[model samples]
Target: MTGLFTFGETMGLVVADGIGPLTYARGFSFGIGGAESNVAIGVARLGGESCWLGRVGPDATGALIRSRLEAAGVRTIAVPDPTFTGLMVRYRRSGEFAHVDYHRAGSAGSRLNPADLPPSELREAAVVHVTGITPALSETCRAAVFQAVETARDAGVPVSIDVNYRAKLWSRFDAAPVLRDLVGLADIVFASPDEAALFVDEDDLLGNLAKLGPAEVILKDGGKGCVAQIGGERHAVPALPVTVIDPVGAGDAFVAGYLADRMAGAAPEQRLTTAIAAGAFAVTVSGDCEGLPDRAELAALGGGDLRR
Candidate 1:
């Protein structure tokens, strides 16, 4: 069976209960959040096989991450380490403002090395998906990502990369060269217009990104939908109209949708349609992976509410 293989840091998340000052918030909800792992879950929910590999601390939080991924139908390869799992705290400061704090420096996930990936899985996967977040974590993690991409290339597997750049993690000066190199190595690349500007000219974002070497280039423009160049085809897919309760994880969902269909040999237009629908579903719910829709749900999107 065709599958998606991914690796990255899945961190413990602590989110304040209600909107307002976190100090006055009475309670918090615990969950897991990670870019690659979220994509794995999204693919699985869309009826595609997916595997996630990462380093996890010897703590309850780490166990929770593994369990959650398993529940979401993703195969997990969690490496145990003495270092603590990473943590991210999020809270809504107001109706429109949300604040996030990261406590992930030197965490176990940051300790990922090239040795963590199994050669067998790397060779067998239909596509290897990675994100900019892992390489930004630490030197070892960066090496691991590079190693995975190289290995996938050697095996003739397609590599998909999402430039999910976090300004809080590293400055553009430090990230530009590294991300540009990764884009050059990828078969398919996903990024926002702003993120693409970090490496290419703002005038022709899609054209410039394709020039960097990726045969497939996608600009995930959120509510504006996406503009993609796949092989010799150019697509402008629109987003499904929906009330967006939370916008986080929508990119991961979009990536997952495209990859799942790509693995199934779907046409470019169908792939983009599924990507847009999945992203629309993600924004209608809360949490990182909880909102990812399955194949059946994708069919019901934008239709009447009553389902027997």
Candidate 2:
């Protein structure tokens, strides 16, 4: 079975080089970013076998996404579509703030359909991961996420979900039920305290989410730390101290860390430790997935300078 299997829309990213207004930005760099693909790359970097299934426009941007995933050791199951690929433009408004604009409505990625999933792949996956962002894209994309989750579940594959709520994509009123249902079906769930509040009371966040049916529920508190209930046992792990370069993909990195370790047969405590280490690696670099650590890099995280 594949160590990890995921499907979602990955967009071409155009980011300004220096910190300033978009109008005055001097240079730009092009890359790809998406929740599922980021996790796939992260798992692959940590020596886990991962595959990504998705649709992309028949354009250079789509090609970039496919090439990058393959180069990172992720198997890409990409389908060509007629609509244009999605794009995200990001620029630092100031030293402390980054502004982002998405151009995904009616794009090929938002056109994902349930028919695109391969049932054979779902059946052979060790863990199937989904994010709430995909369902918020469009009705067809929403159906696709459900179909993927259901197929994986029926095949006895573990289902993992990240409640990656995006205010720009949907309203809380519209997203709550869908996210709640997904959480109910997931075997493992990842959510922030804010995201959990969409379904359950904040007083007993993880407990309420677990009542929804997941065997494991994790509340990611960003730099502070994370709390989780796995197999009915509570585990809390503090975040590692690291310089924050860009926190864009840290959550995905954390998910990948846990999933990779779980697939490698690590205990719950060790899984949390690796997850924290992976998140620290993500924030120490600028691009999404660029700093995801290999086993060696993770081992050398707090080590002193190398001897030549």
Candidate 3:
């Protein structure tokens, strides 16, 4: 019952094999990338039982996504819809800059509805994690997120939310209020400094989040580490230093690490430490979930075995 549960969209990822524009790129690599699913993989890699709940299209891309999820040790509760699967094309050009194009309009993931989530599974998990990305996809997806949060709350389960705001999906003015509403229902919330600023004008971002009804609020600052406000106290943990290969999916790994530790009854500082390490591990790899470390690997990483 302490397993992690998450609901969101998983899309087929087409990454450029070599450093060049899509027009000039000779080859491409296929994988799956999604906030909630990545978190589920992170939890699974850290030795936690986790499940991914979402809808996919009856297409080859959907098949690929599910197979990848299963390979990552995550239990998938994927429903097939008539629409095609969502797709994300990532041009990993060079350095910290990458061009990404989303073709998710009217895709199966965007058509997520509350009816797709099974109540038995929703009520069984220890924590239900969600991201703002799903809600921004469409109104039905937003309703599904709301329903999932409500169901978790009603069944005495904890809810975790990450304010993964994307300007490409919606404007700040439109997203702020909706995101704030989701934050109000979360027990644990993760956000960057910029995302936190959208909710309140306070300099104490974590403190401001606490006022919004979350018991724990985490503020992640890239390279600057992360801070947590939990149980009427505050703790800060520094991120590990590693040469970044890809900047994407690190946030999901961090969230997964924290939740896995929290579920294992680890202290706030320990959770934050693992969270930072997981994030560091993520950026050092190419694929999203490929870089997530196991419990043993993460432990060794903290012990200064920096040779990877």
Candidate 4:
């Protein structure tokens, strides 16, 4: 049993060194990536008892992901299956942008079914964090997510949802209904500016998302900062300026930081500040969740307000 629990696919990432297309790149670095796992890692780094639940291929990539997560203090509950592991290849061009090529079809995570996750494990969690991406994997995975959410809700545990909308994963027939349902059940909801724009059809993004079912809503805007609405009182927090090395996992870090602060009994305004600082710290480091700030580091960045 852990204070925080999250479940989703964790994919192996191969990022090209320097700047070029994946085909032309001669060097690559290996890492693990997934929205839920990233949040678990962030929480673990902040000294929280976080557990990650998922299915992975009984392969080297799965082993690596499990090992790395355990090393970061995250308890991993992985179901092993003999399926090809999911992989993502990232291409970067200096002064330009980065793109990802996903090879996730028929991957082990996409094969996760409700039977794969034990109800006992989910029942023991204090808070269950899920994201929109997991449901997009496959029908069985979608069912698993719904079951997990329902189980958590039935147990009277808090459920946090991140609406990480990836257009490439879902056709028009898939996303809207699923996301809408999830939002209606969440206790806390996190979404970026662009994602919020798509989910809640309003020009004033944060204002629109706040009206959704979640008692607490956080709208993250890169560089510009973040805004939160808790109990009808809104707070806006500015982003800390930092030299960014990579932008991946910033949102996950923010969610983890906010949750950690909330669990620590911090005020809503302080939680927003801590979340912003955590996200700023994440982008300054190379790996996803690697740069997530500990309490001291967070305090140095004015996140000390969390103690108020």
* Inter-residue clash pairs, candidate 2: none
Cα deviation of 206, candidate 2, in Å: 1.0
Candidate 2 TM-score over all chains jointly: 0.97
Residue 193 lDDT in model 2?
A: 98
Candidate 1 regions exceeding 4 Å error are 303-308
**10 residues in a row with least lDDT, candidate 3:** 299-308
Error of 2 at 251 (Å): 0.5
C-alpha TM-scores of all predictions? 0.97, 0.97, 0.96, 0.94
Kindly provide the TM-score of model 3 when superposed on the true structure, using C-alpha atoms. Answer: 0.96
Per-model C-alpha lDDT, please? 0.91, 0.91, 0.89, 0.84
Model 4 whole-model lDDT (C-alpha atoms): 0.84
User: Which candidate, 2 or 4, would have the higher lDDT against the true structure?
Assistant: 2
Off by over 4 Å in 4: 304-308
Q: How high is the lDDT of residue 23 in model 4?
A: 67
lDDT per residue for candidate 2 within 1-308, as digits (tens), equals 87899999999999999998999988999999999999999999888899998889999999999999999999999989998999999998988998999999899899899999989999999999999999999999999999999999999999999999999999999999999999999999999999999988888898999999999898899998899999999999998888898888999999998999889888888888888888888899998778788877776884211211
Task: Judging by lDDT, tell me the better candidate of 1 and 4.
Answer: 1
Per-residue lDDT tens digits for candidate 1, residues 1-308, read 35999999999989898889989999998999999999999889888899999999999999999999999999999999999999999998987788999999999999999999998888899999999998999999999999999999999999999999999999999999999999999999999999999989999899999999999999999999999998957999887889988788899999999998888778788888888998999989988888999887888895211211
**What TM-score number comes out for model 1?**
0.97
Question: Model 4 residue 203 lDDT?
Answer: 76
